[model samples]
Target: MRTAAPYASDPSRVRGRLFAEDESAFRSPFQRDRDRIIHASAFRRLKHKTQVFVEHEGDSFRTRLTHTIEVAQVARTIAGVLGLNGELTEAVALAHDLGHTPFGHTGEDALEALMQPYGGFDHNAQALKIVTSLERHYAEWDGLNLTWECLEGIAKHNGPVTGALPFALAEYSARHDLELHTHASAEAQVAALSDDIAYNNHDLHDGLRAGLFSDDDICVLPIVGAAYEQVDRLYPGLEAKRRRHEALRRVFGVMVEDVIDTSRGLLEGLGSVEEVRGLGAPCVQFSPALWGDLKVIRKFLFTQMYRAPSVVEMRKQVTAVVEGLFPLYMERPDLLPTEWAKDVDAATTDIARARLVADYIAGMTDRFALAQAEVLL
Candidate 1:
């Protein structure tokens, strides 16, 4: 194991869970958190959730679960290199997308729009709900009862929360403050950046595989073209598959190395995790040059992949599915599973009922959602 950097999140000194339990004899607290996340029903549901492509669209396209695993792998790599807490990073990465609605951002957008009157839907906030209250597998607790460090990482991974907070997050923080006004620990920052790296790299690969764009087309982008040129120079007659993999791996390497080198310098003078949070900015990030290049690549992807004609059409279809389902559930809470009856009965206000309806709908998988639409809407 790498010796932790001075500023790394130290699991030994971690803030305890809301519902206290004896520390595991065999596992670090963060390791136990990672295990709990892996075993969560929300994690399994990720397999059938969509990103750019719907679940049944194709076998080769990335599902939410696969994308999450890739994020965890990248997070672990970056966290390991930075001497941060790898287990906590991996837990955050694995749990980051837990609240994403089925059918990718399309579904989330539709849900958000439909939910506008009821304090809006933010995936980050919903993820907080899932961990702190939604999942109910334990005999002693309703949720995973993760440590404050993991919860803080999840809540503030993107950065300091400001303005009006989402309802779910605000509701939780009312009971146990996540310190929403400050940056999360360095491990969480690594997890957040890893999310960016994973999506950008794999979105390109999936776009190519989906026939939305070609390797030739991507080579027109900044870092991609240089990578392709390097691959060609190294192996003049390399086959297309091998060549593409080599080039993209180079692209991936450039990002990882840039983040490590850039962050190492930023973390140089920090002496503790509190200093990491109080620095008033992220310590982990891509270099400015690489970030600019990534922006160009992201724009290309926005047009050629995420907003391609076929994808847009699918988006419309999924949007309708979410739109149709939310109102139906609101009109008919009895349609919610028997398991949800207690909460449904307890929810007295319109806002509470709307949020409850949204919760059930958000927890759905792509196929299950479509099936519900087919049957009810």
Candidate 2:
């Protein structure tokens, strides 16, 4: 591997895991963290979790697992160009969405609404919970016991948390301070932007495939229209599918190159990871012009795909599933799975029992949640 940049996260200087264990003989800490994430039960569940379309809706739509893989690919490329630790970036990207509920944002919104009287739900906080206190695999600890940098990156990758943190995040922060008010490592920032690149581009592709929008519609948009123009100039009368793929690939290239160029210019004088954290803003980002263009693209997507009639209908169905399940499990704790039933029974307060219910529901895959709803509700 290439030497990491001076401002990149250094494994040797790691803050160590929440529960100490012997280092691996063959793997670096970040690599081990990546492997642990890949092997986790939650990671495996992502295969059936929602990205946009419900997992059962179509075979071709991007599920959470595929989206995570795409994000990791983009993140590793950015990290390599910046001479940062690819493994750390990959770990953060891979583990970032492990906390998303059954149906995508729809399920999360429903759960958050139900839990509003409780501490409420945040996927980022739920992700931290999965890595820190859930995922009971190790005899020595509860969660994955990941390195502190990995945890910090996972918690603050979108930048510092200044306002009131969600319950799970506040609970973990009380135990180990993640320095919630500062930026994470540059690699984390790369992973965060990589997420942006993957979702924006892939959503456009998926939206087209789902027949929510058409090529003619997207061909008038800013970055996307330019890509189509370039593709037509190069390959006149190309097959429609091939033409779309080639054009979008160019769009993806533009985003990746913009991030590398923009971040390279930003990191010139940065000498240490601490300096990276203290910069008060992300060092890795698209150029101002590209960012503005991306906003236009996002607005287009919000209207054309995310809020399309078909998608909105599915969202309502899934929201009902989550909303229906939460109360059933809450009022009848015995309805929970065997292991979860034990926790529900032992809970001393309504909030404690509600949190346990959230954990059970949040861990469910789309089909499983639907099946449970069919039987229980």
Using TM-score as the measure, which candidate wins?
2
The digit string of per-residue lDDT tens for model 2 on 1-377 reads: 58878998888789888778999888999999999999999999999999999999999999999999999999999999899999999999999999999999999999999999999999999999999988998888899999989999899867898899999999999999999999999988999999999999999999999999999999988889999999999999999999999999999999999999999999989999999999988899899999999999999999999999999999989888998889889989887778899999999999999999999999999999999989987
**TM-score of every candidate:** 0.98, 0.99
Could you tally the backbone clashes for each prediction?
0, 0
Model 2 TM: 0.99
Taking all chains together, the TM-score of candidate 1 against the true structure is 0.98
Tens digit of per-residue lDDT, candidate 1, span 59-167: 8889999999999999999999989889999999999999999999999999999999999999999998999899998999888999999999899867999889988
**Pairs with backbone N, CA or C atoms under 3 Å apart (clashes), candidate 1:** none
lDDT of 2 at 178: 92
* Candidate 2 residue pairs in backbone clash: none
Candidate 2 deviant stretches above 4 angstroms: none
| lDDT, residue 22, candidate 2 | 92
